[model samples]
Every structure is written in structure tokens, then in C-alpha cells.
Target: MGYSKDAEHVGALGAGQIAKACNNYLHWVHSASNVEALALAKRYGVDAEKMREVLLKSPGDNGTPRNFDRYRFTWHENDIDLVLDLAQDGDLILPMAALTDQLVKPITQGEVVRLLGEESCVYLGQTVAAREAGLDD
Candidate 1:
């Protein structure tokens, strides 16, 4: 399938879905240490350092793409798009309904870093949402 340059054609993925994807990815990313998560990302062909930059400095880290808000992580369209594209292609995301699964375990970025013993940065907007959803435990 061809990619859409016009946000109008692909349109917005909606806040709920975006939130779900972000939260799911963040949860997985932060669920384990840097070694484990990066290994997972590496298996999917993502550069660990690059993934950190994209997640920490991309628009996804700050807020939704539709909103022209400056985020803690200043975003470049090309970089952000590439990272999301890679992440999407990697199949590194959780199913959208993961939020409703009571049997699932809760994991946060804090624990990941603690386990890894290294500083890592991942999208925190999802962290915020997970907290709101009571999933950031």
C-alpha cells in the first residue's frame, strides 16, 4: 500500500487509538530493562539509540500529531515519521484492546530503567494515559 502524504487521506488515527497504540508500545518498551527491550527492538531492526531519540524527542512523546503543540521532545517530521513507520513495521505493538485485559501484567518505564541500570527515555504521554487508566502500575 502506498503511503499518504496528506494527513487528510489517511486522516487522523483518532485520539483513542493513538493513545492505545502509544500506551501499548510504551508499556512494552518500559516493561523490561534496556537490554531486554532493545533486544526486542533490535530483533525488529530498530536502532536502540535511534529509538530512544524518536521516542524521547518525537511528537508522539509530547502530544498528538494533529495538534501543533511544542513538546518536551522537539520533533522533526521526517525523523518522527520514520521511527513510527519502523515501529509499526516491526510488529512491536500490543493489540489495541490490551487495556481491557485484566489478566495482563502492569509494567512501567521506571521499572525498565531500574532493571537495566541505565537511563532510557520512551514516550511518556502514553505513560500519562496508562497512569490515568490505572495501567501504569
Candidate 2:
């Protein structure tokens, strides 16, 4: 076995959705190495540089202030505050529901796709639950 193809599955599990919805607020995550956006990516396991590129180029408010963009949040603060910032305050819906459910317990793979959206499922055509959502394309 070469171990070259070894890959760890992140299973979106609501975390990916959190990364998606909070793109706008990414500038404020406040990690030492990664400005803020990258920190959020690390929180949920995403390529910071890739995330910044995809999200920055996508739609939504560029300067919009969301949870991830807080100027006052300290290092000790929790992620729920950040999620809530983008979700409830920023009007970011998908990540909110996922984050909320995630708080009670870890989100399932199905829940990840449910919030992230099927279009995002570039790998396996989305989660099994996503199939129920129906794929017209």
C-alpha cells in the first residue's frame, strides 16, 4: 500500500454549510495566521485559500458585517457566536439551522448536504438525503 491516496473524510456535517454561509463574514474570524476567513475554514476543515477564492468571487455583501467579521470577539469566544452572527444576524439561513442542530450534537452527513445544497455536492452528487430533495439536473 503506497498510502498516497489516503484521504480523511470531513463529512460536511453542518460544518461545511457553516463555512459557506459565513463567507461574507470570514474577514472577521481573527485567527493569528489566517486573517479570519481562513480560521473559519480551519474550524470546519476547509482549504483557507481555496475557500477565500470561492467565497470572495461568489455573490453576497463583501463588506457586510456578520458573526465571523466581529472586530471585538476575543480568541476565547465560541464558534456558535460566529455562526449566529452570519446566520441569524446576517440573514444566512442554511448554516444557522445546521449550526443549531450541531450544537445539540454532531450533524450527520445527510444534514450537511441538506444545508450546503445539492449543487455543492461535487463529489458524490450530494448526500443520500439530498437524493430525496430531488435532482432535476
Q: Which is the leading candidate under lDDT?
A: 2
lDDT of 2: 0.38
Point out the worst 10-residue segment of candidate 1 by lDDT.
65-74
lDDT of 2 by residue, 51-102 (tens): 5556556663254222222333332224545656556666757653453433
- The residue pairs found clashing in candidate 1 are none
Relative to the true structure, candidate 2 has a C-alpha RMSD (angstroms) of: 17.1
